[model samples]
Target: MSYNLHQLHAFTTIVSSGSLGRAAALLNVTQPALSRTIKRLEEDVGASLFERHVKGMQLTDIGAALLPHAQLLLREAENAREEIDAMRGLAKGTIKVGAVGSLAAHFLPLAIDRVLGKWGNLHVEIIEGVWDRLAEGLINYEIDLALSTATNDSDGIVAVPDCRWEDNSFVVAAFGHPLRKKPKLTLADTLTARWAIPPKGTAPYEHMRETFLSRNLDMPDIAVQTRSVTVLKSLVAECSFLSWMPEPMYDSESKAGIMGTLPIPGISAARTLTAFRRRDGILPRPAARLLDELRSLTERGMAMQTTR
Candidate 1:
């Protein structure tokens, strides 16, 4: 049976608010008007939606059965309206964005600022997570877009080629670390030293493993396994622990003499930092604009800082 959106909206509002008076107040309609709307809806459906009571209104069996369907219809209608608005470039919906820590910390702010300045109705939420979590979110449609260390496409997702940044992150330590002063630091020189590494499944860990194996060396023991950049940076600066990180992660600190890359050859490797989205998902106009801004920002030169 065909149903009007207004009837479904009123029905859902009444169910949510649990009383005619409250629903009227919530919908900003007079009680008689709301009652008539509900009555007309009941006529259309040929079922008593609510069993009126002295204390409050309770949904009848039919109302209980139809409540979920009505809510779904209302949600779909709202989504359709938002999509139309987005197509018109009238920014008025929440855009969910996922990103790794470095992108969230350094690049996201600028991109967000650019979008927020022009569109007052736009809202963006930053979900800071690793590639595994964010990638899963993108595939499952929970995230609208993701900035990741992955350049390649996975199942049900694609990366924007223009938004990708090639990076060569390096093994680093504080300037005061003995390895930094080594006249000729070799692969064996770092094997026994304490290391701070990311969780086992991350890019940094894989890069470290590949760096050692390419040179015919085994992976070394890690002193700490952490996901917090703050903790990793602190350990590398205050202790003798060597850690691998992208240049942007330590640039300002490096200039302050708190961090520096170890000049070990063959240890640095190239990886792409990319912005990704689901292949089947279409972004709202505001989010699409922000995605374009992200591409522009990265393309203009997201350069790694030189070690001080």
Candidate 2:
């Protein structure tokens, strides 16, 4: 059945704002009008979308399922308008990107800077998280692009094959840590060391586990686990904890002599980084622009490595 954009907007706004009155205020319409819009939408759907309550409105199961589809349609409609505006010389659009901590630290900023330099009017929104969150953002249409460690293509998200690169992961510790004094080191030496890392099941955590398991060593007992990059870095730098991280994620700290990679011969490994997008829908132009910049930067980086 066909649905009106106004009705969908009102429905989603109510869900976000948590009440008819607040949504009406935000939409610059009367509460009665907002209510009517939702009623019509519910009629169109042939289902009670929300249950009214003293505190606030709550979504019915159908409404909960419809939210993502509605949001996706709204986002696509906005993208269409932005595309027309750009063609008309408005040069205005928004790029929604989600990335893991490592890419957000350096590579993403470089590409974003280039995009902003060229299209100063464009708006950009970024969410930094692990792969799971990035993938969720893609499926929900919250982000048009995702930069993350390479993973198998899942239900609604697919990698952009050409937009991939490799980064090295290393076992690192603060420069002042006792391990730095050792002329030689092995994975076995780190078994007794306190460790901090991303939570179990994350790509970084899995990589660390595999590194130890490959050599028949048990994973070290983790002293702390966190998703916050700042917390993890502080623990490693100030608390004498060892951690595994991609080079870019800790590059600045390394350059500043705050931390250094352990010289364990086989602990370092390469991980493939990839760009991902929703399997369906045409990517918005602004995201495409940023993706182009990412590709160019990756090519330049690879070229420099080749020359070296």
Among these predicted structures, which one has the highest lDDT?
2
Clashing pairs for model 1 are none
Q: Write the per-residue lDDT of candidate 2 for residues 217-250, one digit (tens) a residue.
A: 9999998998888998999999999999888888
Q: lDDT by residue for model 1 over 173-252, one digit each (tens)?
A: 88888877788788779888999988898877887788789888898898899878788889999987998887667877
> Per-residue lDDT for 305 in model 2?
41
Q: What lDDT is reached at residue 244 by model 2?
A: 92
Q: Which portions of model 1 miss their true places by more than 4 Å?
A: 1-92, 139-142, 302-308
User: Which residue window of length 10 is worst by lDDT in model 2?
Assistant: 299-308
lDDT of candidate model 1 versus the reference: 0.79
lDDT of 2 at 45: 97
